[model samples]
Target: MYEYVRNPSLIHEGPLSKARLPVFLVHDGGGTAFSYHLLDRINRPLWGIENAKLQDGGWWDGGVPAMAAHYIELLGKVMPEGGDILLGGWSMGGLLSLEMAHQIALTAREAKNREGEAGDSGASTPKAPIFRVRGMIFIDSIFPLRLAELVGPLPEEPVFLSAEESRKMKLKDKVNLNMTHARMMVRFWQVPQWKDIPVPPTILMRAKEFVSRDSDENFVDYTRDLRLLGWDQYNEDHGHFIRDLWEVNGHHFSIFDIKYLDDVTRKVRKAADKLDPPDF
Candidate 1:
């Protein structure tokens, strides 16, 4: 079980504004579940996250399916009985969320059938899923398919980081650092594929990396493509690392910028508001 850092003194400081945020966050290769601490203003009542699980230094070998299963179990434990919830993540977490949702839907269907055969009343138990998701949010993460396009087909074998870089890049920072699994999974989806997701109102917060002495002319185009693919709304910022709660801005390739985080977090709040359940 993943233990959470719940400090009473810091209770008023986490990003859980309402009673339950029910948000799932996937941190960067070098980050942890607490990576979203910078956006603490947006109180999230329910948070299911795992940090640095991918930073194992052994490439993409961090158990993606296993992590997903853990969160699904967490949802079973914490989510209100027969309650719907929101799911989202950043980078690899985001990708994992997508896969998790797909698997969860399958599980729910199978469970419903099993219960029906056991004489469970159809009126009491809904045939569809007990929990319907509001939307999925992706923040500054890599899209496996997009990556395969940028870099030729991923190597089938696991790619380990050289010993020195592994020491510098802690385990928390290398979650899903390997490309092998991503390559294998990327082929499952076809391009222009947002239509398949059953959820509504998706958001994709993309980051614009400002390479030194280089013009990112393709940034706008790529962000546009992401929007067309599935994100209901997309915000592009200039930061590589997840924004800090103490400080809105973050460093990208050693360059710090604050405006991007400010704008993106603001947008996240707005998007979240739109996620509020429909009036009864």
Candidate 2:
């Protein structure tokens, strides 16, 4: 029933190599798969992950979780055998990565359990392929509930609340004037389930920006929690998304910048290299 999931077409800077495992890169809020063209600029072979119905008005109305699941299903197809997939996202996409990682880990565990039972019971259960997700990378994403109070209260529609409550809720998140998308991301991130994401995730954040508005004490507390969780946190001197000066439509999110994109792709490569099965 999940075959409807699809991967977006992409333009590539270098030749596609089957030797390299595919990295499925999802875009942030208000972004299409095309928005991740920076991955091409970084000379990485990434399958740009986007929703097929993104052009339709109601595609994102169901909230990020639904879209996240769609992307994850599509990712399963491109990911190589023996667990060689690298999953990464920016902003809202980072939240999606968390959800995807949780699902992948759950799927992998269940598959292993089924295999063991087949031998013990002498049943003819076919060997199911293991969905090995190597690593998850988060860039400039918020910690749970950290920025919600600063962004003000979440609205009562779609991501903010429910779609039925206000038809304009999704539009509110799409508003580029203020940081509405950032606010909604932080609000839902507060859910305890997000903390349960079962993967070795590296969080690359704009350190100064996320904590600049808060007191030094609060910043320390926040960083402490991140460290305690064994999160590999890195600092960036840019906005939540990197700066992209060549954006055709006057959008200036930096996560699309060549320099920033290169930095992240390298980090993802290094993390993947360290995976137990060796994702070379």
Candidate 3:
């Protein structure tokens, strides 16, 4: 599910390994990690967790919970002794990251029980994987539930689907699968269950514009709760504590453009550094 963007970068020699905290990023709507290549190298180990549909022909289990659960299993392959890690993504990817954190917290109890059993079995064995999310970075990400509510009606069927593809899918299957995954994402988060889940330290990067607005106006400039992108509506239980915001120059889809890469990288690196210091 995950692909490395930075492979134990040369910046980390043997002694500096202590500073290597991998950032496992979830994929955006494109269902692949291709766009993440645009990020300015922040020097930390980088990995992108891709959607299963991209390779498995849309037959994988659906919903954010299933995706989150599977991604956690995959994380074990790279960081088996799971400790602290930063979680982040763009747009829908960010929404999915939020679910991943909730799933991690939800399973912590079971993990603890299993960890006890492992400890009892052997004293010299490697620690069983039990990951902790240190913080989250949401790039122009709004809660899908809020979005679905705002967008009200979905089309009966997207006009893109063709008659022949319905009978025997070809390349259009990718487009069909993308819509399937999107619906699954919206459906899963539409229900309000993770409200009680603690909100971790978060860095929310809002684009200058979600859509064209009045001259000199940004989308957050009109939100009821300031710049949160309507997240305060569902995140009602846990008030913002470690949350920070960084405004980027561009629309939601175009914010990852190369021109803003350095600025974006700086804000993310600053947030990650605060979330997990070297001593941490």
Tens digit of per-residue lDDT, candidate 3, span 55-174 = 443323456667777778777766766777788888767877887887787677567767788779864434557778888888777655445434335444333335455456654566
Judge candidate 1 against the unseen true structure and give its global Cα lDDT, from 0 to 1. 0.47
The digit string of per-residue lDDT tens for model 2 on 1-280 reads 0122246444343235434444566666555555466443433455667544433322344455656666655654554243556666655566667666666667677777887888799886654335656565555554444555544465655333344533554543434312344345446642324233344434344322233434432322243245211233311211112211111111124445555566545544554344323323
Q: Candidate 1: TM-score? A: 0.60
lDDT per residue for candidate 1 within 1-280, as digits (tens), equals 2134421012123333235435555443343555455554554453535532234442333355554555566555444353555566655556666656665766766676778776755444444325556666656544444555644455556655676777787553554454344444444443222333343345555554433334432322333334332232321221111222111133222211344545555655555555653232
Residue 129 of model 2, lDDT score: 39
What TM-score would candidate 2 get against the native?
0.60
Q: What TM value does model 3 have?
A: 0.74
> How many collisions between residues are there in candidate 1?
25
User: Candidate 3 overall Cα lDDT vs. reference?
Assistant: 0.64
- Name the weakest run of 10 consecutive residues (lDDT summed) in model 3: 6-15
Better of 1 and 2 by lDDT: 2
TM-score: which is higher, 2 or 3?
Answer: 3
